[model samples]
Structure formats: C-alpha cells, structure tokens
Target: TGKAYELDFNQIALDPVTGEEQGRRMWGEVSLSRENLMPFLYKLHYSMHIPEGFGIELGILLFGIVAIVWTLDCFIALWLSFPAWRGWRKSFAFRWKQGGYKLNFDLHRSGGVWIWGLLLILAVTSVSMNLNVQVTRPLVELFSPLTPSPFASRTPVSLDEQKFPGISRDEAVSLAAAEATRLGLEKPAGGVFYSPEFDVYGVGFYTAENDHGDGGLGNPWLYLDGQNGALAGTQIPGTGSAGDIFMQAQFPLHSGRILGMPGRILVSLLGLAVAMLSLTGIVIWAKKRRSRVLSDQRRRHAEPEMQAVS
Candidate 1:
C-alpha cells in the first residue's frame, strides 16, 4: 500500500548483464497516487530535484541554506509579533469591528503566535533532514557515538567469498528474531537484504521504540554474514546515544507519526496556516504599495499649489 519502491534491477531488467535502464514489475498497486505523490512532494518541497537529471545534492544544499534563512526570519517575526503585557489578551483575539485591515493583521499576527513553535520545529527538522551530513549529523554526533566512523574497520565478508552456501532467507530472519529477543526487544520483526558489494546481509529490525507506526525511526540494525548466518554486529536503539535518539525522532516529528492521527491533522492545518499567512502578507504588501503611490500623487499636486502661493 504505502510502500515507496524503485525498479528492482535484480529481478526484472531489460539487460541484466549490461545493467542498462529497463522496465520493472509492479509488485502492488495503490488505490490512489500515494506512492508517487510522497516522493514527488519530497523531491520538490525540499528542492531535492528540479530537472531530475543531475545536481540533486547541490539543489538540496541551496534549499537547505534558504531554509536556514527562512527559519531565522521566523524567529525575528516571533519576536516582533510578541504582545506587550497590556495587550497580551487582546493579541490572542481578533476584533470584528476593527475593519478589514485590522482583521487581516490580527489574524496574521495571532495565527503566527499560535503556530510559531510548530513552524520552528518544522524548520529545524527540515534543515536537519536536508543537511544531514554537513550540519545536523555532525551537530548530533558531537554528543553521541551512534554513527560509526568511516575509517573504522568493518572487515565484512564479501558474498562471493563464502566458504559454504549461504543460509536460507528464513534462517537469517530466525537469527535476527533470536538476536532481537536476546536484546529484550518487544514486537521484533526484521528483514535482510543481500548486498553484493560488501558480501554481507544487512538486517534491520523494529523494536519497542518504534511502536507508534511503521517504525522507520528508532529501529535497530545489524550486519550478518550471508554464508553462515553469523551475527557480525548490532546497533540497539535502547542504548543509542543522544544524537542517535534525536536523529531517530526527526522523521516522526516532521511527519507527525509520533502523535498519530491528530498529529497528522495538526501538521496539515499548519500547512494551511502557512499558505494563509503568505497570501495575507501579499495582500498587505499590495495595499501598502497602492497607498504609497496615491500619497505621492497627492503630494505632487499639492506641491504645485504650494509653489503658486509662495
């Protein structure tokens, strides 16, 4: 249903030997465009892809910078919109008798105050997700040892160098379940992927930490030997460092998966609020520009009359 997948070259391909672009087998179909819509929004919303050819990383970098700037502006807007002690209550409520301009201004100002925290969270999480390696990851890792160093010796066995035939898929999964149980994980489920380059089985599992929804976040993972089903190493979410926890929480917080249905509704409302604020801002700007032009015209007409009187 909600799974996002790419073409499985190993299964269905035009030229398996050459590995050229080919058709794919659709494993399942959704009732709507849910599968395609998410990726399209993700790519466009975060500036991950424009023309869809090249420079995706560069596009993300540029958008990451813009997000940072926008977040800063949001902070400034929050500071500026803060109501004084005398007007604090008034700031929370809109006055209908104050006319259109005041209504628009109050709605714009108060609605912002209402959603600033959500906006800030969205902005921070967006930056972290987009600039993971450069900014967020490093900042997170500064306090935690979740991510392994690049120079660390994995010494993983390659799939081709197997001494004996590899274990069956079911056996590998059994080992993962056993490992999960040994670690006291609740409701553990795992899957293994055969990586040719490393010659290892990458097994990832969901645990209690991921009890909320799909468990994409806060999942423990490990590498297993494809041949003998030996447990190479494991990363447990329960004992993960602060950085690991923060990074894991990012997706859930961004997508409102942590809070479930109500959380999703709130996020959707926040999007509408942002759009409303943007439109009101444009209207305000246009009205100000019109007023300025009319004032200038009046001043020019009065200037000649003043000159004649002088």
Candidate 2:
C-alpha cells in the first residue's frame, strides 16, 4: 500500500490508519543501503563499528576512554608547548623560514597551541557523547540539577518483549504539538520516533530543513508514555538548570553546529589541522627515536674501547 506505516524491529510494517499489516522488509536489507551512508558514518564515529554485546557497547566504552585520555593530553600538550616564561611567544610561532623537520615540529607544537581550546572542547564533548550516563551526566549533576532522562528512567525490554504503543504516532505528535503551543514554542512538529525498548514516543519540534539542528542550541523534544500518552519528559533546550544547559550544548559545540554553516566549515578545517598535527607528531617521534638509537650504539662501541685503554 502507498499509505503511511510504521516498521518495527521484527521487520513487520503496520498501517496506523487501518491497524493492519502493510508489508515487511528485512531489517538488514533496509538498513544496509547506499542512502544510509551518512548514518553509518555517524555511528562509526562514536562506536567504531563495534557490535553491542553483554548489554555493553564495547566500542563506545573504548572511545570514551580514548576521549578522556585525549582531554588530559590536551592540557599536557599545552604545558609542554610553553617550556619557559622568557620565550612564551615561541609556543605560538611557526618556523616558516626553516622548512622540513623544524616546520613539522612547529606545526605540532605551535598549531596545537593556536587551537588548543577548540581541540580541548572536541575531546571533552567526545567524552560526553560516549559516556553521558557513565561519566558526563553524573559530573554535571554534581554542580547543577538535571531533569531525569526519560530513556534512563525506564528499563528497556528485550526485542522479543517489545510492546506496541496504545496511541498512534499521529496522536502522539498532536499531543506534543499542543504541549509545545502551551509552552510558547514557535516551531512546528518536525518528526516522531518510537522506542520499542523503552515503549516511549518522542516528538521533535523543528522544520524539515533544520532536522539536523544546525543553529543555536538545537530543537526541543517532548517524550510521551506509549501506554497512556502521558507526558514523560521534555527537553526544551536553553531552558533548564546550568548543568542541563551545558549538557544540551554538548553536540552543538562539538560539531560546531552552534554557529551554523560557518561553524561547520570551521570544524571541517579544524579536523584537517588535527590530522596534520598527528602526522607531524609521529614524524618528530620517529626522528628522535632514530637519533637516540644511533647514540646508544656509539656509546656501546666506546665503552669496550675505554675498558681496553684503562
């Protein structure tokens, strides 16, 4: 049928209008397609394509640990960049006149010094993204209050035990729209999503064009209970405790979407700079290792000669 329908994890598609089976598509068949490239890359960034097992996402945990290490490394790098107060300006200057290894060293140290703040922001936000419940949320809550997360509040059921919602997606969207209006929100209902595990429906407030939430603190979302359509929680960005606002700003700040197209462009360039710094850092390390090895070899040869002379 050409009519609208909702697909479940079991590969069953049901028409909300008729409450009848429409058709079913294999889950992998639909997901593993060319159109899903962006979504695949997005997941890869945070999860590294690791499969979930034993109720733990190993990929996410691994990257979260990496982010924590990277955050600490940023501060250490900054300190190492400035060796003395007498010539602190050297940390920010590039040795453009002397190219090759000197330039590479300068790029690694000076380039890092120039954009150290941005790099730190990215590292910290990566941790927040991967370890929100485990680390970020708890840390944020220590200083400021946070409304309970709807996803965390509910225990997720197994796929076989998934429950279908009593109200339709349309009804949930309407309820959310009404709530948005009552709360003086200006945006229209953009989309609706159902969580089979948690049995909750979330209606996002935004336009189709702004679905990615390019500007500001991103869009607001209303979550409702599946069984009775009761309001479960609301995430109206820019309106919450200090910690709540900080948490809301994480993705926008990390992706540089807070500044819209210009922000995205800057972030793209920043990524290139980071790659360059890593390459230069490796080159510097290799050259030093080679010199150290040669010095050790010479020292060993001289030690035998000195013993014989003595």
Best model per lDDT: 2
* Model 2: number of backbone collisions: 0
lDDT, candidate 2, 28-115, per-residue tens: 3225565455656777778777877897999899999999999999999988999997999998898899999999999999999999
TM-score of each: 0.70, 0.90
C-alpha lDDT score of every prediction, in listed order: 0.69, 0.90
Best by TM-score: 2
Full-model lDDT, candidate 2:
0.90
> What does the lDDT come to for candidate 1?
0.69
Q: On a 0 to 100 scale, what is the lDDT of residue 251 in model 1?
A: 71
Residue 308, candidate 2: C-alpha displacement in angstroms: 1.8
Residue 255 error, candidate 1, Å: 0.7
